[model samples]
Target: MPNWVDGHPAESLSIKDRGLAYGDGLFETIAVRAGRPPLLEYHMARLAEGCQRLGIPLDLQLMRTELLAFSAGLGEGVAKLMITRGEGLRGYAPPPVALPRRILQSSPFPVYPQVNGVEGVQLFPCVTRLAEQPLLAGLKHLNRLEQVLARNEWQGSEFAEGLMRDQSGRVIEGVFSNLFIVHEGALITADLSRCGVAGVMRAALLDSARAQGLKVEVRDIPFEDFLQADEVFLCNSLFGVWPVRSVTGHHWPVGPLTRKLQAIARDLLDI
Candidate 1:
């Protein structure tokens, strides 16, 4: 299927579009199944928050309509939705009145080894550290040079993902996923108040854990504490959850809690 720009099928974007010029936008990677996005509500909620935070005007109703139409055409795949501040002059100041641009692109779903979701995977420790930016924290903003750099630090299938940390060496997240650790029967994930993307799958898992009466903690997790976790797992909108087997010299078993939450995530993603 062709890409949609501002709700119509298209092939190219304007040269002056702010998203291209300055990374001035937000985006969501949604998983579509049977002509529908299973996590549409979660994706939209984050997009709404990002629009409000960036003062970018967005029509949620219209976006929803377009997304539904786009997903129907693609059927089973991944839908990438980008909302830009639209075309702008060559400068830092945004246009006095912003006209947000909506872009939708389709791609085939990723194919990972079945062992990743079953037997578990290893993580590579990335040298690139995330910068502290409270204003952009958790928004899934378009500026992702940090993630790009971290992702490139690795070479092959030996590591399924790279573990990213903040400037202070606080364990934050994965290259393209959220991290969660189970310790002494409580679920803990790093707080994104200062950095990191607040992934939709992470939100869904938190909600499901809470609903199931599991102890969940969204707080700052130190590297030492993370290494001490009984079980660790990574999650994203597309891949559901993957039990983390090891990182660096330390190691961890694919514990029962990881399996339980993995089951919840699989159910949520309908995979």
Candidate 2:
């Protein structure tokens, strides 16, 4: 239940921290269960890629040890690890000597209806479009205004998740989770090379789906295709997977493939 900033217990960040000033940081939301993080490698892989692209140095081994300790402390919860470029002066340019700051915090696992994963959930199509920034695509950086605004568009339990698209109306992903649709017995998900966070759960599912000999395709999904999908599901590290029952008026049954993958997720995530 302790929050650590650079290995020290700190509740507040420096006002000049680059993460606050310009959203110059990367974050990973890790699900800790039974004193361990199951999908940690996938999260670390993405974080490492993000740090490399942003020119931030990451000692993967060190971070792994820290995260394990953090997870053990919390026992069961979500661990958020934020790595920033540390404090900076007023400017757009990064400092020559990058003093990266690591902030680790934990929160209780979210409470949701048990039927969410069993039956399925309704999705609200959001109007807030994700900009096509190839440079920022697939990275879980600190900048999340797009998701914030999209999530703010709806309220209450009518929709458990919201579907977001690119400005061109290409179905991208969920406000938080990645989108996957079963089409003609194939598992299809958005191509995140242009925009959207390449979630750890998405990556893991892709591998698992392929290992099970399921057809998997990552490509641009049109709104019509998404609506016509045999079965739809949303996934993230925390929730594992949630089938989408409807979007607008279009409806889908919790299909065979969705259930198959849900079992895989439960095994992999131990949720």
Error at 192, model 1, angstroms? 0.2
Q: Residue pairs in steric clash, candidate 2? A: none
What digit string (tens of lDDT, one per residue) describes model 1 on residues 1-271?
6699998888789999999999999999999999999999999999999999998999999999999999999999999999999989889799998899999999999999999999888999999999999999999999999999999999989999999999999999999999999999999999999999999999999999999999999999999999999999999999999999999988999999999999998898899
- In the predicted model 1, the residue pairs found to clash are none
- The candidate 2 region of ten consecutive residues with least summed lDDT is 56-65
lDDT of each: 0.95, 0.92
Candidate 1 versus truth, CA RMSD in Å, comes to: 0.7
Model 2, runs deviating above 4 Å: none
What's each prediction's TM-score? 0.99, 0.98
lDDT, candidate 2, equals 0.92
- What TM-score quantifies how close candidate 1 is to the native fold? 0.99
